[model samples]
Target: MERVRITDDGFTTLFSTEFNQYYHSVRGALDETQRVYIELGLLAKMQETNEINILEIGFGTGLNALVTALEAQKNNLTVQYTTLEPFPISEEDVSSLNYQTGAETDLLQKLHHVKWHENIEISPNFSLQKVNCTLQEFKTSQLFDVVYYDAFAPSSQPELWTVETFTHVASFLKKGGFLTTYCSKTVVRRAMEQAGFKVEKHIGIWGKREVVRAIKL
Candidate 1:
């Protein structure tokens, strides 16, 4: 069973007793999502086009997907999001989250309740396909405009941050597509470069110094 805890900021995060890790920083879950993935990854791409396709590596808590959906709705942009997660949280645990408090809460619930492996339209402009698989097992020929590489740190799950792993994911991105993550480790950045990404560093969210944004060129 997965153990979870609510942060001081009132957002829920998964605690991996096995890994001795938390799915997100205790500083603020929503803040980190907005800063790293939504603002840097999605919004940056949104500036280039009105429509976007996004691939997410770790779909823990479905927070990134929900925030992306809300941002797309706000900007009136079309989004096609595909996410991979080998272990999904239970519906009961999802229901207990206090992430969203208003009309957005319904949208968040819809995101969790929707069927996996099928592209389901969550709203007029946001469509999602949740794949229940690991990154190595995920296979698709479709290309994406953005990727949210929110995997666990290399210290805990080093294999996921390797050149081989990034090469696999980069194969699915269109030229100029961007992959953003909260991880800014030099080895990870080098791995992304080895995978053919033109990598750049950006200011990270609170408590973290830097993050990475890599471009498929």
Candidate 2:
């Protein structure tokens, strides 16, 4: 079972008693996604091409995908977003989220309502394909331009942070593609480097001191 907690930054986040962790930062969930994933990962590459392909490591509450979809619609950018999640949250939890306001709540609902394992056009420019599987079990011939590495923390799920896993995930990226994550540990950076990514640390959001952006060079 999951519970909701209002963080210091005035946003609601899901707390998983199973993992003993929150799905997003305790400071703020919406702010974190916008700062780390949309601003740094998606918008940074928006000017380079009109169409962008994005892969998210953990779909979780679909917050990252929702913001990306809104941005895509706003900027008239075409986006192909593919996300992987082994276990999805319940609809009750999704409905209880306080992320959006007024009419925007409808958009959030539609995001979660879309069926998995098939491509769904969220808007004229944004398309989503939610894969109901873990990264270890996910396989695809398609290459992505950006990867949102939003998995659980290394302390909780150490296996997902291994060099072999990063290398395998990196194989799905096109040349010059980048992966961003909230983790900035030296060991995690080194693992990304060993997996053939040129790693760089950037100022993090809210509670985090720094984040990493790794490029496939």
- On TM-score, the leading prediction is 2
What's the true lDDT of residue 1 in model 1?
Answer: 39
Candidate 2 wrongly placed segments (more than 4 Å): 206-208
TM-scores of the models, in the given order?
A: 0.94, 0.96
Q: Model-by-model lDDT, in order?
A: 0.88, 0.89
For each of the candidates, give the backbone clash count. Answer: 0, 0
Candidate 2, 1-217: lDDT as tens digits:
3488887778788987767789998887888898889878998988699799999999988889988988898899999999998889999999778878564668878888889999999889999998999899999999999999999999888988999999999999999998999888999999999999999888887645888889998
Write one digit per residue (lDDT tens) for candidate 1, span 100-173: 75866587788888898999999998999999999999999899999999888888889999999999998999
On the 0 to 100 scale, the lDDT of residue 112 in model 2 is 83
Q: What residue pairs are clashing in model 2? A: none
